[model samples]
Structure formats: C-alpha cells, structure tokens
Target chain A: MDYVEELKKDFRYIEGLNACINCGVCTAICPAAEVSEYDPRQIVDTVQHADNDEIEMLLKGDTIWYCGECLSCKTRCPRGNTPCYIIQSLRSLSIETGLFIESIQGRKQLALKRTIGEHMLKYGYCVYIDEIDTEMFPEQGPVWEWLRDNREQILTRLGASYRQEKSGALRKIPEESMKALQSIFDVTGATERFKKIEELSEKKAREMKISFNSGKDDYFRHLYEGHND
Target chain B: MRYSRNEVWETYQKEIADNNFYFARSCIRQNVLPAAEDLFLKIIGTDLGKNIYDDARQTTCTGIAYHSGIIPFETTMTVVAHLFALMNEAGYENYACSCVTSFGIYSEVLETWKHFPEKEKEAREALKKATGKTFEIPKNLVHASDLIYKFRKEIANRSKYRLTDTTSGLPLKVVDHIGCHYAKIFPEKGIGGAEFPYVLAGLIDEWGGQQVDYPERRHCCGFGFRQYLLKSNRGYSVANSKKKFESMKPYKPDLIIANCPGCSFFLDRWQYVIAEMENTTYGENGYGIPVLTYEELAGLLLGYDPWDIGLQTHQVAVEPILDKLGINYNPDMKYKGAGNSNTDSPEQPSSIKMF
Candidate 1:
C-alpha cells in the first residue's frame, strides 16, 4: 500500500505538520523524552524536512509505540503543531508497510482486529474487555461475587433488563450488514487474528490457572483487564 | 435546586407518597454496577423508596454501545422494547436515568417507537412471547441531571456543609465536563446550560466553587465507540484532550471536574499516561493537574473525607492541591462504607441498583 498517499488524503494533519518551527520546546517538555529517547521534536523535524526515510524509520522504531498520545505538545505548541496526530498517521502508515508487525503493539494489534470482528459477529457492538468475567483470577477476589452483589442495583441504575425479553431474537444479524462487516474484518484480517488471540489467550490463561470464558463478553472482559495473556 | 440521582431519590422516598416509579440505566454503568446502583438508590430514595416496585422486565437502552457500534441496532431495539416492557410491568408511564446516555436512549427509542408503531408492536409481541410481559417507553422520561437541576434551590437549602477556603479567599474553580450523552441526546431538556451548559458550573458556583470557562469544554472525550477502538491513531482522543487542556491550561484551576465515569477516567488518567507516552509535562509549573469526579469534589467541599471516597486510588493525585489548600486528607481512612450501603449519608448518597 502507498501509505504516504493514504496519509496525504487526510491533509488536516499536514496543516499541523506545516506549523512546526522545529522548536525543541516540545521535546524538553515531553514525558516520553524523559522515559525514553523518542523525541517528538525530532519526529516533527523529520516530517517537516520531508525526510520520509527517517520518518519511516521512526515509525518502525519502538519509540513510536511509547507515545501515550497525551497531546501535551499539541496543547502547548507555539506553532499549533500536533506531533501526536502526526505520530498516529505515521503508525497507520507503518502498519500498512508491515513494519508494525515486529513491535509489541503489533501483537496487541491482533487483539483489536479480533475484538472488532467478534463485536460485528455477536453484539453488533464493539466488545470492550472490561465487560468480561474475571471471577476466577481473584486478583482482587472473586469478581463475580462482587458483581453479583451489585448486579441488581446496577441494572436498576442503568435501567437494563437482566435477561433479554426475547433471547433468541437478538441472535439474528441482517445478512447484508453481516457481510459488510465481515468484509471489513477480512480486509483487516481481524477475524483470523482474533481467533489466534483467543486460542493463545485461553492457552496462556490455562497455563497461568486463570479461567477464560468464551464469547464476546468474556473476550472484552479479559481485554479490559489487560489480561490477554 | 438541582439534586443528583441520589438526592432526588432520597427526597422521593422521604416525601413522595407514590410507590410505582419509572427507572432507567446507562450501558456503560451496566459494567460498573456500584456507581450505577448508587445513583439508582439515590433517585429511588428521592422519588419513591421501597414503595416503588422495580419492574423486572426492564431492558437496556444499549445506546452507548450501539453508538459505539459494539452492539447492533436490532439488539438495541430489542433492549429498548425490553425497557418499555418493564415500564408496563411497573404500571408507570414515567421513567428516569442517572446517566445522560440512558436518558438520550430512552428519549430516542420512545420517539422511534412512536414513528414506527408497527415495529414497536412487533418488538412488543416478540418480548411478550419470550418473557410473558409487554413493554414500552414512557411518554415522560427524564435524565436525573434535569430533575436535580430542576430542584436546585431545594438541594441548596438541604446542603448541610458550608464550604469555605480560608487560604485562597477565592472560590474553587471547577471545570465541568458534562456527559456527551446528556448534551447530544436531549439538548433542550439538559440542565446546566444545555447548549452551552454551564448549569453544572453554576451549581458548582452555588456550592461555593468558581466555574471556570475553558475552550473545548463541549468536545467529546473520543471514548465514543470508534475512538477507543481505533487505538493505532488515538487521533480523536488526543485532539479532544488537547482542546480541553489547552482551553483550561491558561486558567490554572485547582482541578478539572467531570460527571461521567468514562470521561473522568480518560481526562484524569490520560494526562499522566499520555505525558508518560509523549514525554510532556501536564502540570502547571511542571506539576500535574488533578481531575475529580463531581461527586468526589462535592464530597470534599461538603466536608466529607476525601480518602473515604477512594480519592487516594485516583491516578491524577489531588494531594498536592489539597495540601496547598491546607485541607487534611487521610489516604488510609476508607469511606465508612466504601463499598457498602451503611456509608450512604443523607447529604452524599452513593448507592446504585443495576436490575
């Protein structure tokens, strides 16, 4: 994929890129700089000079993954530059080039793909990991007991019914929408990736003596706890 | 006199002679049961206590997840009908929510049901066949915020603690981040200056706190479905945070405030996480800004111990600011009933029910 052209399509970021005066102020104030050698100022400098090769290298580097995307630079930049957005654009570009495949974030990437696919398949909603059941782990004791105690109160508060008035009715997804979502998932290789993660996560969970539940809810629950082991 | 769901519910239980009441909940709160139930009990306590029979047939608004594309439209509709059935079961035509999202979902679903009576009928039948009960959205559903703001004066009168800042001799500047579901779902009904809602800000001022005006005050935290998922870029989250932080950075307020848990989580934690990721300084004069939930902040100003309310667990620490204000905070002192009902006070009720 011609990632540069893909990014060029969204020129809003270019406006931000154009505003950079190469001031090291962003770097001086950057938390990532303190924690790691990744420099926002350098990334801005490279992009400003149109050093595509250097930009590509920076994108592929582990340092880019270190960005918390806090936007402090964008908030404080005198030139109104948003290095954070630029870094994201760079990440998308790097992903296209398969450079991201080598990073830890790349491993996490499969989790996203899987989550999107599962949401499309089951809930028609993106399943967040926080919704999963982490009862068995007992990191803080049985999560289910904790949830059980407040379940009624929670449902009443949110006004959600515990059981579907009609359970099976929710299973049916429109053929066309399902296809469209599936195609998107396929294009992104999300389905395959998700399956792999699920298998691997379950395996890891079993090895670690952590209970792993199947289905979208469990997937998201584990994901939320960063327990995709 | 705007009262939070708890304040309203408590008042209802104490004063209202009605037992049949309407109820609603937000999708996000479905996962975080305690917060949701705390608000629910408060609303119930204020409106109709034990006399109010909770209809078991209630369904989810499923708005946030649906809006986020995590849940399908068909599922959302089914959930909507389920809520309607609960209302039918309870035999009440009125409902309320502690969350802006639930309120918006209820309103939207109610309107949709009106527009598509056939579809509504189909859903009703489907639900009836499955649960042996019928459901429908009430003609009058309200966000708890609206109800609370409606009775702002009463709340003020009821307030027990008188807040005074001896050192600054100035009111605390509070920046309000009203939930997006509230502003976007029912613009007109929302209290706190719906369009440019400063109602919460005003309420803060009424509580002896200064409401600070900041740019990007109305922007969504990009926790909106697509934003949180599209982690590769985090473009929306970053942009939204930047706008708010930049707008407020100049004011150098003591704290940034939020109503919703998700928004609070992002605004409060994102700064530290992002700063760590981007290597940037978020604090004023190289110090980080503390983000507090409206409840937490209110509890503080009301003379409630901050530690009791889980203030210590907050990622963006409020210690420096509290210390600067010469207020004593016992990090080890847990709120009397941090996770139990016994902790609920008449002034600051926090119990919530899920079903």
Candidate 2:
C-alpha cells in the first residue's frame, strides 16, 4: 500500500525528517527512552533505511506508540530533525490503514477516541468533570469524588460562573459556536476519522471473538484494562 | 557543545505584550483549578489595572484531542484559527492562553503558517467556509505565566508576605517545574529557554524563595495526554512523576510550583497515590510536598483568603507551607460552601496528613 509514500505526504514528515546523522542526541534527552524500550535514533534510522515491507512492519508494530509526545526530542536533534513529528506522521498512517489494532498501546486509540474525542464534540470541552467516573480512575482518590459531588456549590464559592449564560469559568459555549466546531471537524475529515476508528475497532473485536457493544463496552474495557510495560 | 549561558540566553529573549489581552481559558483548568483563571484575571485587571478581557463565545482549543491522536492537525489548526477570529472580533491584538498545551499548539501552528503559506491559506478558507469568521494572526502570542513573569516585580512590591519561614528566618526552598511543551518545542518562545526556563524562577527570585535545581528538573510531569487518559497506561505517567520526585527529594524543597494545569494536577494528586501504593512520602512529617499553580502563589502573596483562592481543593495539605510562611487561616472554613454554607469533607487519606 506504499505506506511510506502516504506518510511523506504529511508536512511534518517532510520538515521533521532532515538528514539523519544517527547521533542519538534525541534519545539521550527523551523521557520515554528512559523508561521504555523506545529509542528515537533507532526509529529514525529504521525509517530512513527500511524497505517497503519493513516499513509496513513498523506501521503495524508497538514502537511508534511509545512516544509520550513531550517533544523533548525536537529541541536536541543536531541534524535539525524532529523524531517526535515523524512519530506523529507514522501514527497517522497507522490509524489510517487500520494497522493500529495490531499492537496493544496502539489499540488504546479507540478508548481515547470515545472519551476525549467524543467529549470534545458533545460537551464542547475535552475533559468534562461530570464524566469522570471514580471507578475508572481510582488514582483520583476520595477528594476528587467529593469535589465532583459538590461541584456547583464549590465552583460558585471559587467565583466560577459554572453553566451560566456568559463569561466566567466553565461557561457554556453557545450553540452557534458548537455548530461551527462541528463543521470544522466535518470539513477537516476528523468526523470521518472518528468513524473509521470505531468501525475498525469493532472489526478487530469480532476477529478476537470478543463482544463489541458501542461506548465503553466489552472490547473497550479490554483495551482500557490492558497495560504494557 | 560548550558555550556561554549569556550568549545563548540573549538569542532566546522574546517580547511580551504589556497589556490589553484576550484571555483563552483551558478546558481542564476550568474543571480542575477554577480559581487559577479567576485569580489571573483579578491580578492582571483589577490589581495591576490592565485591559484583560474574557468573552463568553470562546471555546476549548481541542488541543487535548489533537495531541491524543484522535483528531488530525488540520482540525486543530482550523479550531485555533476560530479562536484567533474571536479575539479579532473582540478588538484585541495580544492573545494570552491559559493552557500550556494550547500555548504550545498555537506556537506550532503559527510557525507552520510562517513556513508553509499554503497551509495557512487552507486554514483561512476552511474557517470562512465553516464559521464565516475571518481572522488575522495575533501580533503577540504569550502564555499566562509569561505575563506573570513580565510583572513579577510589581506583584512582589504589592505582596503582603514573602516566601520565607518566619520561625527559621530563612528563604523557603522551591522547585519549579515548567511544562515540557512550554519551551521544549521552541526555546525562543519561552522566558529562559528550554534547558533553563526562568518564567517560574523569576517569580521565586523576586518573591523571596530559592529555586532548587535537581537532576530531573526538566523532566515532564508525565501527564502525557495519551498516557494519562488511558487507565492501563497510567503507570508510565506516575513513574515519570516519581522520577522527578525522587530527584528533588534530596534537595529537601518545601514546595513545588508548576505552570501547567496537568502538571499541577498529577504532581499534587500522584503524591497521594505514591504514598498509598509504596508507603513513601517526600515532605516532612508524613505530608506530601505542596504543589501550587503560579496564580495560587501570587494570590497567597497578595493576602487573598486561603479558601477564596481554592486551597481547600488540593489533595496535599497546604497548611505546612502556609504555617512556614506565617499566613493566617481559619481551619473551620476549609470546606465551607458559598455564603458559609455547611459542606461534607471527604474521608481523609490514611497516609498523607490533611487538614
């Protein structure tokens, strides 16, 4: 499918992939490299020298998802390269080709899509406080639960105009603005991209003989619960 | 690879607008740290007498989704363009962003537009087709912390207290954690550049605190949007914070100050998680180190009521630092609702001490 060709079409791939000197400066400074098996120098070298079949293997593998997107790598690359940006392009191609499901970390994109992506379109905010379930997030502890329960009263005390008509913290976005945001998503192909993620995730679930109900169902729970070291 | 710090820092200095700002509130900050934004507007507008405005029609920059790989870059660019259009309609040339992620994305998008004019054309056309709103790029793009750094001396002059321990008569040791996105992407866009950013340090320098430089000072707080968003990947997130905490422990800093909302959130909350999971603590006498946003620090220095600035919402007890600084607060009003209404306190954690 000419995966490398499709990746090069993105501007980040062009601007990010300057001549690679294989100096490993980015790897030394990368936070992900410290804790994980991920290495920016190796990823750049693989992409620079790998063949079409080898490139396909990388697109469907787990290495690309290891980047935390901190972009610390961008600041240190002596060759003027940004391995982080190249990783972004690789992730896009992986999702576009539906090869993301082959790896554990890459498959979590569905969970992110359902939570952060859907929330952006529906609530006009990325992380809606009301939607945070304590069971799903035990690390939040009891204080967050208390805060969520007494949200309106506490927000008011802090001078927040929560859910009010206009101005102040957590104010509702107007309907016209929501429509404009929706139109941007539709025009920029994000709406279709979201649909693609769901459809492919469902297909993968069927292949694995798992139940695939929509929105935090059995498959979503499986991916959300699966951890990678 | 060795060079003089002065020669390198001189090239990184960038101009910050003095006043007349159009504020951009963050999605997470409004939910997590609502007072952070409120205090910023109050400090900049009422106290400092600047022309800072917030409009009701503005919305999230969709940066969280964009960075999570759920949405494409074009969608983010179009959404950011809409934000600039709102600022243009409101008659402000300086854009002050509340979220570090949004600030980084804005900087990235603006740089992209400069390098690739065709992409900018596409974004303008897309904005016109969808919202019928036209925008001119902001004359100045600055993060909220940058603005505070610009006026640190003024804030210090008006401060009612210093970051000093009254009992010991010594300056409190402080750790400053700048968001990775703040300067890592483009060093020239930040105050002191990436390796050594002075935005938060400038505040500590002027406000009577010593800035502690640890081994992992530049490490990310590990709120990597994707890593923290997924439940399974959170270990990686917490471990990164643990790395920073371990490195800073030997220095024995009294408090940690973070400029990013997510950094403040994880650094504060994860201390409780670490204590519960590993039976370890970084602060003195079984207490976790108190992490405060830059605005929260400014508000405290100005003698704003503790509850009024939302210190009660933190997982780590702030009383230690407040006591160290000799600031007065009524323990009874810690969890009170609006107009002194009665409220219930959450069951306290067994590990870290809470008020």
Candidate 3:
C-alpha cells in the first residue's frame, strides 16, 4: 500500500504538524510515550522525512496503536504541532490500507466493532447495562448483578423509562431513529468500514486457530480477554 | 479568534445561549448515572424555568466508535449533521450535550467541516437526502456542566445541601477530573483555559467544597476509547489511571466530580480494579474515593434522594461518603425497594451492608 499517499489524503494531518524543531517536548508530556514504547516525536520524525518504509512499519506495528489520543501532545507542543491529529490520520491510513490487519490494533478492531460498533446500532448506546456481564466485569460487584436483575425497577425509580416506548432518558430508542442511524452508517460508508473490520478480523481469527461465532466466541473471547502487555 | 495555548481566561466569556436549549442525552451517562440527566432537566427546565428539549428522537453521536477508529470522520460528521438537522427541525439553536465526548465530537466535527467546506456539503447532502431535513449550525454549543458553571451562583442559592459533610461537619475535599476533550484539545472552548480549567473547580468553590490540585490534575481518566475497548490493551488504560491515583492518593480527596461520563465511569470503576491489582486504596480507609458526575453532585446538593438518583447501582459504594456526609438514607433502602419487597440476595453486595 502507498502509505504516504493515504496520509496525504488527510489535510488535517498535514495542517496539524508545524515546524518541529525536534525538541521532544510532546513525547516528554505524552503519558502513552511514558508507559509504552510509543513516542510522538519519533512518529513526527518519520512524517517530516516522508519515510514510506518507516511509516509502513508504523502502520503494521503497535507503536501507532499506543497513542491514547489524549492529545496531551497537542497541549504542550512548543512548535504548535498536533501529534494526536497525525496519529488519527495514521490510524485511518492503517485501516484504509489494511495494514491495520497486521497489527495488534487491527485484531482489536473486531472487539470494538462488535461491542461498541454493533452495540450502538442495536441499542443506540455505546455502553449498555444489559451487555456488561458480572462474570466478565467482576469489578462491578454483585450490586451491579442485582441492578442488572432489577433494571426496569431501578431505572424507573431514577426517572428513566428503561426500554419503554415513552420519551424519556433510557427509553427504548425509536424505531425510525434506529433505521436512520443504520442509514447514516450505511450512506456515510462506516458500514463498509465495519464490514472490512469484520472480514479482516475473521481472517486473523482463523490464522490464530480461534473459531469465530456470533457472540463471545473463542476468538471474540480471546480479544475480549485482552492481549500481551 | 487565535486560540493560543498562552491565553489565560480572567473572566469567563463565550456564546452560551441562556434559554431554548436542545439537550442531547449521553449514552454512557444515562447507563452509569441516569439521574444526572434527570437532575439536569429538573434544575434547568423546572427550577430555572428554561425551555430545554431533550428529545428521545436524537441518537448517539457514535463517538465511541469514531474515536476508537472503527468509524471514520466523514461518517461521524454525517451522524452529527443528522442530529443537528433534528435539533433544527425542533426549533432549537442552542445545543447542550450531556456527554463530554459528544460535546467534543460535535465541536470537532463542526471544526472539521469549517476547515473542509466540501466535507460539510457532503454531510448536508447526506442528511437532507436521508432524513428529508435541513439544519442551521447551532448558535451556541456547550456542555451541561458549562451551564451549571454559568449558573453556579443561582444553584448555590437554591441548593438545600452544602459541600460540608453533615455528619463530619467538615467541608468536603473534592477532586475534579476535567475530561481531556473538554479542554486539552481546544482550550478556547473549555471553561477557563486548559492548564487551569475552572469548569469543575469554580463550581466546587461556589458549592462550598475545597478543590484539591494534585500533580496529575490534567491526566486523562484512562478511558482511551480505543485502548480501553480492547481488553488486552486495558493495561495502558490502567497505567494512566494508576498515575492519576498515585498522584491524587496523597491528597486523600473525599469525592471526585467529573463532567465526562466516560471519565466518571472509568475513574469510579478503575479505582476498584487498581485496588484489586495493587492491593491498595486511594480514599479514606480501604474503600475508594467516591466519584460523581458534576450533575450528580448538583442533584445531591439540591437534596435529591440517594436511591432516587440510583446511587445503589454505582460499583464503588457511595454509602461511605454518604455516611460521612451524614446524608440520611435507610440502610434497608440499599437492598429493599420502596414499600419493602423481598429480593434475591447477592454475593459480595458492595452497595448494601447486612445492618
């Protein structure tokens, strides 16, 4: 894939970078850079030099994945550079080029695709209470278990009409709204992106010998279970 | 408007429409802190006598997916366009978002459209073709907390409870976790400047709490949409949280108030995770610091019932702080519902004690 061409497609990424004197202040303030091997300065370094191979290597590797996108670098850059914006474009380029399929982030896309990506279309929420199981997230404690069991009652008491047709917070999202949401996803090309994520992740899952099924299957569990530190 | 990082806000100034608001509900905030939106509606719509429309017809900003890189910018922009179209159809111009991510995403998308006018055209065509609706860009867009900060003195005057714990009779030591998107990205839009955002701090001071500024004050709450969504990469999320907890542990804050739904959820839940991982606690005793959305705190200050606000659903037990505040709540209310019916007994019930 022509990684530089993909990066060039994003004007925001080009504008985000100012004259980087390479002072390394952004990397110094970056928490991801601190805890992980990700360095914003180096990513910027590769961008300025137009190093295609280095940029390709970045797309296929985890260094680009390591940005938390906190934009702390945006906050402290002496040259007014926006490393986080560059990171965003790189991520987009990675996905567009299918280079994301080669990295850990690429594999993790399936998890996000299923949980957040699908959850929104299905329930109109990114994080729904019913989907969060106590077994997977034991940190919620048994009180959450009780709340899960008594959802309608608790949510009602809190003044939200949970799953109800009436218009209030937590009400069952309207049918047309859901359809419009799906249409937005479709017309805007995000659905295609979601499908690509599914296709690529399925292949990756097969390579790992992890069978993929509908929900929380072997590969899904593996991704949900987490990856190497 | 040259939004320089060097600007210091001596007086708060921005285009915050005072009335006729279109309130956008947050997906996470509703699930985690349902009563927050309820209380916000109560305070603004009823108490303050403002006409705020929180239509159920509006959908999620799809921000979680967008920020996680599953959804691209153009897609999210189209989604934003649709939402704005809905708001425009409803005859509301002022947009107040309940979620920080939603607020930030709206701002970011609008800015992106501003930079790339053709993209805005595409989004408009997409929305108009799909929904048969047209939109005018909002005259004002602000977070719900920004409204609260704008009306802090009014809320202070109307509030039934102060920040002082009723039992201890001491002022609450508060830690405000301002979401990164709120200020870090665009400091000009944020209340005060990014470095010393007084969004939560100003409210805390007005409401009678002592704001504690720790070393890691500006740290993200580790809800890296991408990092945290993938379970294996959560260590990165926790590492950032660990940094904040370690830095704030010295302050021994009584309550944590945050504007961002994700931050509030992450800070509340990760404290428990961190405790289990490292076998240490950050708050008083072995429990963790109680985290509340700024709206939830506003609800509490307005003398809202603990159970009515769904405090029981919180992973980290709020009972400790409630007890410290001498907030009167029947111990049985944590288990039994109104009128006292039998329910299944759960294992390790943190919200309830067998008293």
Q: Each candidate's TM vs. the true structure?
A: 0.55, 0.97, 0.94
Scored by TM-score, the top model is 2
Better DockQ candidate (1, 2): 2
Best by lDDT: 2
In the order shown, the chain A TM-scores of the predictions are 0.59, 0.95, 0.93
Best by DockQ: 2
Complex DockQ per candidate = 0.04, 0.75, 0.65
* Model 2 lDDT per residue over A92-167, tens place: 9899999998888888899999898988877788977778868888887777887788888888888988778788
Q: lDDT by residue for model 1 over A135-209, one digit each (tens)?
A: 422211122333344444323333333434421112233343344344434433444444555565565446556
What residue runs in model 1 are displaced by over 4 Å at the alpha carbon?
A1-229, B1-21, B27-60, B160-164, B192-194, B233-235, B279-287, B301-303, B320-328, B334-355
lDDT, candidate 2, B1-355, per-residue tens: 1125534544667799998999999888887787789999999999899999988888889988888888999999999999999999999999999999999999999999999999999999999998988999999999999988899999999999998989998989999999988999999899889987888887887899988889999999998788888888887789999999999999999999999988998999899999998889999999999999999999999999888998888888899999998999999988887888878997788888877
Candidate 3, superposed: residue stretches over 4 Å from native: A227-229, B1-9, B166-170, B338-340, B349-355
Cand. 1 TM to true fold = 0.55
Question: Least accurate stretch of 10 residues (summed lDDT) in model 3 chain A?
Answer: A220-229
lDDT of 1 by residue, B204-261 (tens): 6566666666766766664544345434434446555665777777787777766665
What local lDDT score does residue B114 receive in model 2, on the 0 to 100 scale? Answer: 95
Estimate the overall C-alpha local distance difference test score of candidate 2: 0.88
